[model samples]
Every structure is written in structure tokens, then in C-alpha cells.
Target: MKTSILRWLLDPLTSLLALWLWSRDRGRRPYDAVWRLARVTRHPDELLYRVHGHRPDDPGDALP
Candidate 1:
């Protein structure tokens, strides 16, 4: 319960900070920032590839 509350409060701040860094670095795409942030915050098994039905061994499953 406390963990969930902390996550809810912190996740947006973390994302904003990540995006600010990415922008300062002149990253090519905003989605890249989001993807990078997700990699740190989310479980590998719960990543976009799984939601999109990509197999673990599929070439498309590779991270950017």
C-alpha cells in the first residue's frame, strides 16, 4: 500500500526528470526516453514486447 503510493507519486517525477535529461542530451526521439525509463522501472517480462505479442527469441524483441 505504501509502496504503491510512493510509486504513484514518484513515477511521474522520475519520467519528467528522465525526459529533461534526454532533451538536454538532444536525443533523437522522445519515445526513446520513455522506453529507457520503462526499462528501469518495469520488469523485463512486463515490457512492451510481451504486451505486443512478440516472442522472447524474436529479433524484434531487442531493446533500442
Candidate 2:
């Protein structure tokens, strides 16, 4: 387990190199794309309500 954790920490060298190479080109990094996507979804409650189809007045079926 210790070895796995150490590897995970050091694994960024490869990703860093990839990002550096991508910067040389005109392509964007995967991390940036994910961050942009997350920024667009800042409202969690609104998104969840749309997904679950819940209404403000509709309390749903009450359970005993």
C-alpha cells in the first residue's frame, strides 16, 4: 500500500511532461477542459432539481 501511494505521488511527472508538450502545441489540456466544465455547473441544487424532476410545491408521495 505504501509503495502504491508513493507511485501515485510521483506519477505526476508523466502528466506534467504531457501537459508541457501539449502547451507547445495549440491543443488544450484535459485538466483545463474539466475545470471549465465544472465552473459551468456551479449551481448544484438547480441542476439536481432538473434531473430529478422535483417541483417546489410538489412534495412528492409522503411515506408513513
Candidate 3:
């Protein structure tokens, strides 16, 4: 419960940050940027992946 609440709070902030950073890049697709940013999170799927295009199970998309 506590973790869920924390994630709810932080997700938006990180997403906004990712979009801002993505805007600056101008070369990356929005979904790609979100995926890159979301990779740092404990659970990317719960954040921006659903709204964006990429699925966590994509063949080569796993985080290193």
C-alpha cells in the first residue's frame, strides 16, 4: 500500500521530466523517451508504458 502510494506520487513527476527531456532531444520518439526514462523505475509498466506504445515484453527492450 505504501509503495503504491509512493509510486502514484512519483510517476507523474518522472513522466513530466521525461517528456521535458525528450522535448529537448528532438530526435527521439515520445514513447522511446518515456521507455528510456521508465527503465530506471522499479516497474515501468505501471507508469507510462500503457499510455505509450512499447510493451515490457518486447524482444530486445529489456533493461541491461
Candidate 4:
């Protein structure tokens, strides 16, 4: 079906985005990545240092 095709197409993109967000560098630990993604989406202030637009860390930014 059309939805299945769309899901297949978007799944990789979603995975890639999660990888990018969860990854600090190319050498990302898979478990850490998943945990980070979940943590950031739910309670960003708890674990995430910063997340502002395209910049993950800006000097002007402060963590909670």
C-alpha cells in the first residue's frame, strides 16, 4: 500500500535523525543513543546539556 511505502521511506530518515541527535560523534554506542533519544524527548532538562535549533551547544545557552 501507499502507506507502507511511505513508512519504509521515512523509517530510515527517522532512524538517521535519531542517530544524529543521539550521537555525539561517529562512534555512538547504540544503547546510549536510544537512551539519549528517549531522555531528550521526554525530559530534556534532566540529561541534555542543551538543544537549541541547529546548535546543540551555544555559549549563551544554559542548562536546567
Candidate number of the best TM-score: 3
Rank candidates by TM-score, best first.
3, 1, 2, 4
- Each prediction's whole-model lDDT (CA): 0.55, 0.44, 0.56, 0.50
Query: Candidate 2 residues 1-64, lDDT tens each?
Result: 6633453376545445444555665575454443223323543444434333223355665534
**TM-scores for candidates 1 onward, in order:** 0.33, 0.28, 0.36, 0.26
- lDDT for residue 42 in candidate 3, whole number 0-100: 40
Candidate 1 TM-score, true structure as reference = 0.33
- Local lDDT at 40 for model 1: 54
- Cα RMSD to the true fold for all candidates: 8.9, 14.2, 9.5, 12.7
What lDDT does model 2 reach? Answer: 0.44
* Local accuracy of candidate 3 as per-residue lDDT tens digits, 1-64: 6733554476766555555666777746664545356545645556644544455656577867
Say which prediction, candidate 1 or candidate 3, comes out ahead on lDDT.
Answer: 3
Per-residue lDDT over 3-59 for candidate 1, one digit per residue giving the tens place of the 0 to 100 score: 435544667665565566677767865544454555455556555553342245677
lDDT of 4 by residue, 16-60 (tens): 555566565555545334544544565567554423233646556
Q: Find the 10 residues in a row with the least total lDDT in model 3.
A: 31-40
Candidate 4 to truth, TM: 0.26
User: Measured by TM-score, how close is model 3 to the native structure?
Assistant: 0.36
